[model samples]
Each structure stands twice: as structure tokens, then as C-alpha cells.
Target: MGVIMEMNFNEDDKYLLAKKKVEKIKGFYGNLTSFILVNIILIFINLYTSPNHLWFYWPLMWWGFGVVIHGLKVFEVFPSFGKDWEEKKIKELMEKEKNNKNKWQ
Candidate 1:
């Protein structure tokens, strides 16, 4: 036989979780917009100022790496630290705390 567990959450809790997810998506979009706009400006400046030197790519590449990681995290593409990991960690910690309290009592 297999064991099944149900997790119940109230309406407010569901709403708050949904709102937090939306906020994360919104933040990712904001980061992407800033990355595009700033990189555009940097490219223009590099082209106009140095032309042959081409140093704009330095910041673009590094900042782009950060943006990519941020997108991956926000979209939950990386499972290591995603929703399941968070819930599991939370439960684990709660269980540990309960055990400690019981030991003390």
C-alpha cells in the first residue's frame, strides 16, 4: 500500500502564495527590461566612443549571466531550490524543532 498525504491551505494563504509568485515574475521582467535597456545604451556608447576597443561586452556578458540565473530561478527551471525543495526544507526544519522541544521537555 502507498501512503498519501493531503496539504490544506486557507484561501488567504493561497492568495498570498499566488501574489508572491506573480511578484517574482514581475521582478524578473523588470530585471530583463533593465538589462536590455542598459545594454543597448552601453553598446551605443562603446560603438560611438571606442568603436574598435569594444569593451561593452564585458558588462553585458556578466550582467546577462546574472539575468539568466534570475530568470531560471523565477521560472523554477532549477529544481534544487524550487517550490518542492522549499516545502521539504520547511517541513524538515519544523520536524527538527519539534524534536528538540520534546527532548527538552
Candidate 2:
């Protein structure tokens, strides 16, 4: 009936959304697991060669910040700029293009 994509969520869509959320959380867990595993290996490697210089901590801290943010996003601890924002932006662009087209014609 309408040309524009529907912005509403039906009951079926909720299941898809929940599945996507679970996937995100599962991905974060995988990321965290890799982080821990690799860091443990690096820690031993660092100690084996140069016990004084601890370079592994450098990546540990920086990448750990990224992991934290990823977790926050997955858990929705931080609000996302979501579908509403995307839809509004799309509408704005379409209006701009329409106005430009009108001018050309």
C-alpha cells in the first residue's frame, strides 16, 4: 500500500530482533575469550624474553577499552542511534533530493 518501508515492528519482528541481540552478545563473548586467551599467551612470551619491558599491557589496556564499549553496546547499557534516527535521516535526504530535482526540472 505504501512506497516507503514500514517503520513499525510486528510480533514476528520481535523474535528476529531478540535473535540479533543474542548474536551480538554471543559475539562479544567470543571476542572476550580471544582477548583473554591471546593476552595470556603474550604475557608468557613477554616474560620469557624481556621480563622488564611489559609491552603486552599496551594492547591490553587499549583493546580492553574497545571491548568494554562493545559490551556496553551489546547489553544496551548505552542507548543506540537506532532505526528511528536512520529513518529520519533517510527521509531528510530524500526531501533534499526531491527539492534538487524540482529545481533541475
Best by TM-score: 1
Q: How well is each residue in 1-105 modelled by candidate 1, as lDDT tens digits?
A: 122234578999899999999999999999999999999999999999999999999999999999999999999998889987887677777777777888899
What C-alpha lDDT values do all the predictions have? Answer: 0.89, 0.80
* Candidate 2 Cα outliers beyond 4 Å, as residue runs: 1-8, 80-105
- Kindly list the per-residue Cα lDDT of model 2 for residues 7-71, writing each as its tens digit: 67798998898898789989999999999998888889999999999898987898899899888
Residue 38 alpha-carbon offset, candidate 1, angstroms:
0.5
TM-score of every candidate: 0.92, 0.69
Candidate 1 overall lDDT versus native:
0.89
lDDT at residue 4 of model 2 (Cα atoms): 50
Tally clashes: model 2: 0
| Each candidate's clash count | 0, 0
Clashing pairs in 2: none
